[model samples]
Target: MNGEVLVGILGGVGPAAGLVLHQEILRNTLNDGTDQGHLDVVHISRSSDMAARPAYLAQLEAGETTADDDHNAIENPAYGMARSLSMLVLAAEARSARLIVGVPCNTFHASPIWDTFAALVAAEHADHVTLLHMLDEAVAMIGRLAPHATTIGVMSTTGSRRARIFHDRLEPAGYTVVQVPDHVQDALNDSIYNTEWGIKSTSPSIHPRAVQNFQSYAKLLAHMGAQVAILGCTEIPLALTGSEIYGMLLVDPMVALARAMVRSAAPAKLVPLDIKLPRDVHLGKPKRTLSVRSDSVDLTDACETLR
Candidate 1:
């Protein structure tokens, strides 16, 4: 793979997280002056059917883990989660993606949905379209940068907690996971659900409550002597900064996935950018959100010139 390739995103599992992943991918790509567009990005956002994500989580939290039980009144286990994921995989495949990166962390956290994606890939026999595991990338990054970090604060959905997503992966590596208190967890969920930074939320910018919500949790983690907090959920970074948290480090798995993709690219294909960097681009906050649910949402179509 020394040539340019099309990368697809199995996105809109929740619209908010998908936008961040899409933005990070473009922000980190090789930008040359000759080409106005950065890279070949094919985005496939699931239809309204992907709302099963929050529904599945609600079921798990309500103690209905059994397959026969209804998920959040959706009347099925995983609430059509597996089917929705399969559909997205098919859509991504239709776009001829060389590599497919899924944006939602909760979708990957759900073992059934994850397994469905894996099986679909095997069935398609499309080795040209590669799927990268976000969890594996995050854990590997943690080992590399903070091997000695024992206490990691995890901010994710209730579904991920029950599945022991980050804890299961980190514990085997000799790290202890620190959990947020019930009150903070409630506020965390509130920030995501009732505020601007959550899935499909259309707030113009990060809301004050959202910032307060994440700041309070980060401050609490610092009090508990947490070395770093892992933004395990894709929506988590929408509220909390992905890089740092009140002197403590914040590990974003989505960001880890994006960087891994960049690093994995061939040197010849990874051309050097010849653009002047803008100070405002560094100082600005993420104000954009992809609220669309079409088959493909191309952010590059609206990408601005380097200032």
Candidate 2:
């Protein structure tokens, strides 16, 4: 597996998240005085039909619909996720990449699909593909950046709202997960998934209503004495430019994951390790077998040098 580390992005869970991740990677590695890109990346932007899942689930949960009522919506996500993950594996094998990362923070798909995807990759590739889970990164950042923060609010899509992985991971870390009210959640979901971020649209247009909804969510979190608020959905940071709205720290998981991914890609050194089985792997988890080092080059400096 001696080759350039190509990063395969399983994107289009929401287009904005994929774009943001690409932008962050470009920002981090545009200049290294290398003719080739600092990191080789392969991205698949297939639109995962997450919008239909919530509506179908809502009906099923309400007993208004049977399990067989919306099998297409129910089954589509797993297929999409598996397809995306499979594509990552193929790309990794083609590039002989050492790292493979996915940016979808939706707990619904992530919980069920991750292990299956890992197994598929492991069975086929074995010890070559590494999965980077983003939720763990969010939990770790909250602990490090705002350790004493008691109440934390999340602004994300309906999928993330239903999954609650962020909440599950954060609660044990001593933070109260304040969910936006149903109406507020609907507004946020509609603003993102129902619009351009949805299956039909392509252009990255910012929804003013969504931005206002997030702003209102931020205010509500601040009112609830939340020391920090997380933009749980990937599209959120694209909507809300810059942090600190109404004096609350808006933590963008995509940006956090981006920073973490950069660290993961730039290792101190590569070492040979016998990875035999599937295990829970989180980004930034130290591997005693490998010594990794990264030279912190300023983005501005990198850009200038590249130009």
Q: Evaluated with TM-score, which candidate comes out highest?
A: 1
Q: Taking the tens digit of each residue's C-alpha lDDT, what string does model 2 give over 251-287?
A: 7666566556666776532222222322211112111
> lDDT of all predictions, in order shown?
0.59, 0.58
Candidate 1 per-residue lDDT, tens place, 93-132, comes to 5664455444445545556556655666666635655667
lDDT of 2: 0.58
**Candidate 1 global lDDT:** 0.59
Clashing pairs in 1: none
Cα shift from native, residue 247, model 2 (Å): 2.3
- Give lDDT: candidate 2, residue 78: 44
The true-versus-predicted C-alpha distance at residue 96 of model 2, in Å, is 3.2
Best by lDDT: 1
